[model samples]
Target: MSNDVFTPSRPAPGRTRFTTGPLPVLLASALWGTTGTAATYAPASAGALSIGAATMGFGGILLCLVAGRSALRVLRSAPVGLLLTGALSIAVYPLAFYSSMALAGVAVGTVVTLGSAPVFAAVVERVLDGVRLDGRWALAAAVTVGGGVLLITDGVQLGDAGGAVAGTLLGLLAGLSYAMYSWVAARILRGGRHGSRAVMGAMFGSAALVLLPVFAWTGGPLLSTGVGVAVTAYLAVVPMGLAYVLFGAGLRHTPVRVATTLSLLEPVVAALLGVFVVGERLGAMAWLGMAGIGIGLVLVLTRR
Candidate 1:
């Protein structure tokens, strides 16, 4: 699950960038989009909490292993408050994200979680860091988030209002958690005091410590069947571990807002997976919604 595709190359004359190109980030996001589809294969006994815990807990360890001494150093030397903040977000994100999908189905949950992240990220930056949103970003966000809203408009069944409501709320939590971690991680990378690998490893590892006990309570079912075990392993190794490695690479040089916008790819791919692999049905409007999100993503990336 290595991502050699993100290896840095020499920049053009007078240009210097260490971050990965969009291709790598897009590829990583495509991998992440598979999480919901993969989770669908898990046994019914494997709850969302267990799925999230196994993915992050195991993936965090793998990331730490990949980062080695740098990861340890960052974890030890980083400010306690910063580490705690990042870790709290990390711990909550997967739990809420997976729960959202479990309750709301893949397409809607993925859309809500990833679609709202850029907005949350923008607000976090503006309020805390005093960064201002540009018109292009505002336009892109509007179109993308509007598309996400379209996805859930007619998708939820009449009697499932409670589940839909709870799922959407959890999705918001996931989005905010994601934005917080991304902003914090990007800020840390901007400082040049830690590499992306170290930051990801430290943040996720700390989160794993917080999540392990929850996994103990809920994860036994994930190991009950071969299919469950395999799905869990795939989620950890590919989407959670390898994808984050590529995400870390991208974050090295990309602005946090841009990075969050680029991540819209995840939901688009997830929607397709929900329809094809997960056997979820989507109407023409849902397809159009996916297209709108894609268009918005293209606009944002090209505007940069």
Candidate 2:
């Protein structure tokens, strides 16, 4: 069956993209928020790289299975340069993201990666698409990024200065990779040819081929315990697979910059989960930062 079956409907009259677009992205972000906490449940034997590889590798395959022939069609017909760029970006994201968290603290890594994505996405749109950024988006982006930094930076310890530097660099690379893939997918979807699922599956499935080798190299520990296996399964199925499905759907109605900004909600959800589920404590600044993120999101969603 064609992946167009999953295509979202157009917004009703009087509803703007800002009004209708953020919901699916927000939902995807919520699912993505569970990833950090979920990774904690994995066995010690499971290295961060292995966990990342398994998550994207299995999840990408699942998306390909779901997209079926449509994905194959997209691979055949989409611009080769665009497809390769998107696929390579997708492959790099997980590896850099996981490694950054391993070297830097989770807070620093998450903040750097997610916080930098909106800016990078905006730049991509500007340079490649000739899109101009408006004041509202700029303000909203600044607010969201500031909030994210404030929210995640509480009590962060960057052990080993050299490792921190390396991790921060990797985090930046991950952010750029994220922006590139988002732009490429949005570009493909905007072309009005392939379905979102087809684009997602084609790009990510090719990325899976690249990542599976890494998984094979580092994924042995995942088989060492039931908890590890379960964690890996959950990460693959829920956050990586289903979340990207929602993300792709959101991309249909949302601009890349807005979509990336909306995704700031992920860290908020992650922080809440960390506090409530993982018994981590948050300071007043963290609460204040969360509020800032909420305000920023409201700005992004408002239609003027």
Candidate 3:
């Protein structure tokens, strides 16, 4: 786990945006999509909260270290409100996301969490940032969310009805938290005082502080099993640390809304992993739902 994976070569002056920008983000999302599948390999004793906390808490510190002095400077000089909200959202996202997967199963949980992010981003942009919504995005979101509904209704039941309900709610919260953090990152970038690495470092580093106690409490079981420890380490290093670096690079050329929507690949990857690796079943309706999401992503990605 070197941060070198996040470091894209400098593009030539005439290089396409795809090569220098969205590709990295898409790759990052693909890596993110593998998280729930990978978590399945962990020992059963590992709680979702602890997994989430460890992923962000430990990984965040590593990100901060890589970001170095500029990251610290940005943390010190950034507005208190922005920094606090970003950190808080970051802290909440992984907790809600991992728990959602545990209760709802990987496919449904990842679909709900990642699928809803674009909608949240759209709303945040409109209400807070005053960015206008284009018709393509609106239509694309409707189609994608419609697919999400199908996945939710058609998802394989995990625990009780209460667990499903709770997971879905938490998934929505995860989506909101994700959108909030993305907005914060974009805002920080707009300020031009900090680089993307610094912005991410600042946000997650503070979030790591918030999650450290939770990791300590719930992480005891993680150490009980060697598999759990290894999986946790993988999650922290690959998906959390390296993925965010690529994500930051991607955001350089992509708007938050488009970036989030592009990340819909996450759910598709998660679903594939759930079916292939985790032995989860996706019924016809769920397959159709996945199709809708795919179509929606294609529409959005192809739009001028």
lDDT of each: 0.81, 0.89, 0.83
Tell me the lDDT of model 1 at 82: 78
Kindly report which residue pairs in candidate 3 clash with one another: none
| Per-prediction TM-score to the true structure, in the order listed | 0.90, 0.95, 0.90
* Candidate with better lDDT, 2 vs 3: 2
Please tell me which predicted candidate would have the highest TM-score against the true structure. Answer: 2
Model 1: per-residue Cα lDDT over 86-135, one tens digit each: 99999999899989988887666777888889889999999989998899
Q: Pick the candidate with the highest lDDT.
A: 2
Clashes of 1: 0
TM-score of 2: 0.95
Query: What would the per-residue lDDT of candidate 3 be over residues 1-304, giving only the tens digit for each residue?
Result: 3332233344454347676567888899889988878887887788999989999999999888888887888778889899999999999999999899888776667778887899899999999989999999988888888886686577466678888888989999999999999888878776756777888888899999989899999999886888888988899889999999889877866788988988887877777787898888888988888898888887877777
Model 1 compared with the native: what TM-score? 0.90
Candidate order by lDDT, decreasing, is: 2, 3, 1
lDDT per residue (tens digit) for residues 245-275 in model 2: 8899889888999999989998899999999
Candidate 1 all-Cα RMSD: 3.6
